[model samples]
Structures are given as C-alpha cells and as structure tokens.
Target: MTLQTTSAERVRTSFDKQGMLRAIGATLTDVRPGSVTIELRPGPSNRQQHGYVHAGAVSAIADTAAGYAAQTLMPEGRTVLTTEFKINLLAPAVGDRLVATGEVIKAGRTLTVAQSKVYALSGENQRLIALLSATLIAVDHVED
Candidate 1:
C-alpha cells in the first residue's frame, strides 16, 4: 500500500470529525495518551436481533479509538488514518454498555501500531468481548 512519509514533522492537532462525532452522539467517553474508551449502550440501534450489540459497531468503536490513540502521538500538521485493522469477537456482547480501550504498541516513522480491548461493562467487573489491532499511517497534508 502507498503510504505517506513521516518527514518534515508537523504540528499536532485534534481530530475534528472524530472529536465532533464522539462529542455529539458517539458512545466514546474518554481518551488519553495512547488510550481511548468507547461505550455502547444496549439499545435497538446498537443491538442485534439476539439482544446483543452488533459486531460492526464493536469494530467501528475499537477502530476509531485505536486510530485516535495513534493520533495522540503524532506531530503537528500530521494526521493519522487506519491503514489496516482486525477484530476478534470473543464473547456475547450482552451488557448495559460496551467499553473499548485502545493502547499504542509501536510508533514508527510512518506507522503506528495499536491494540484495543472491548469489554462488556457490568456493575463492577467487565467481561472481555473483543480484541482489535490496527496499523495507523501518519500523513502530513500541506494546506496552501
């Protein structure tokens, strides 16, 4: 795959679209350096016929969190995009809310590698439902 080089380091910036979506209606709740947490409430919109959250939603949240986690370590003028990802659904996502936490594993000159774990949060303990990993590419887009 064709990827951008990580030369001419740029200033770091927040992800506009991502922040907006998460701020408005997205289930994502918290984010920090090398980590993110997303929540998915059990509802008709997010659930399957079997009364469990859809796998796609699980993946989407995990990917977004992982991508943003990678973004947190990039320089200014540089942005991150997920180049590839994989998710392994482990258990039935049956709970009130699903929380996905992502952490960066490797940050390279051109790519950031991260992993996320999805948990079905109960009252006190959480159950592991999915595991996700992604390779994020850093791009320095110039504006005139």
Candidate 2:
C-alpha cells in the first residue's frame, strides 16, 4: 500500500533547522511520501585521515534522511525521532558529491522502519558507500 504524505514543506522546514546538516553543507534534494534524499558536497572539513568522507558523517546524513522520510508519512503536528539504526560501510566515500536516499519500508502508528543508501558521485559514476536500516518513533509536537 502507498502511504500519503501530509506536508512536504513542513518536513523541509524541520530539516532546515538541523544544525548538523547546515554545518556539513548538506542540501535537501527531494521529499515525498515515505521517501527523501539529501546531498552533500564533500570538503576538507568532512574528510577523514585517508581523505575520504568520515563514516560518522555518512551515517549521520543517512540516519537523518531515514528519519525525515518516516516523518513525511506522519500526520500533521507529529514529529519523528530516530530510535535506532544499523549501518554498513561498503566502500570508500571518495567523490565530489555524496547522496543519501531514504525510503520507508513500513509505517506503523508509533514506529516506522526505513532504509537508506549512501552513494558517492563522481562525474558519470556513482559508487555505493553505505547502507542503513533505521527505526523512527513518532511523537506529538508540543507547543511551548
């Protein structure tokens, strides 16, 4: 069954508030029902000892993407949080740009399961860098 999205703009707005994404220069490329994509241009600040993008950074983007993807399917006034995730680093993240795509596998009342894949993009080439499976929990947004 296909899940309907309530507000893509709201999701984008929430994503914009993430300081980590801003610090890493990540952009929200797409947002749809049960799916979202984030892209980042790797720079010196994000590189590891071998000049590759840090694994933590890669995982961060993947995790954020997954959480947001699940959030896209949630009702209005609901916020999503990452409960947990497991990731596998498959290849060295060496490229001009890194893209992470997340899609919801199952959407439940409280918990949603999502999967994300990170790819390193060079000119005309894309290499798989990592994969992640995550669980997200929905919570009511409280107005203070």
Worst 10 residues of 2 by lDDT: 1-10
Please write out the lDDT profile of model 2 over residues 6-52, one tens digit for every residue.
37887777887889888877889999888899998898767789988
Residue range with the least summed lDDT across 10 consecutive positions in model 1:
1-10
TM-score for each model: 0.79, 0.93
Backbone clashes in model 1, listed as residue pairs: 10-76, 11-75, 11-76, 11-77, 12-75, 12-76
For residue 9, what is the lDDT in candidate 2?
A: 80
Per-residue lDDT for 55 in model 2?
90
- Candidates' C-alpha lDDT: 0.73, 0.88
> Model 1, range 64-132, lDDT digits (tens) per residue?
778877766776567778899999999998886788888999988798999999999888878999999
RMSD of each: 6.7, 2.6
- Where model 2 places Cα greater than 4 Å from the true spot, the runs are 1-6, 142-144
Error (Å) of candidate 2 at residue 35 is: 0.6
Alpha carbon deviation, residue 71, candidate 2 (Å): 0.4
Tell me the TM-score of model 2: 0.93
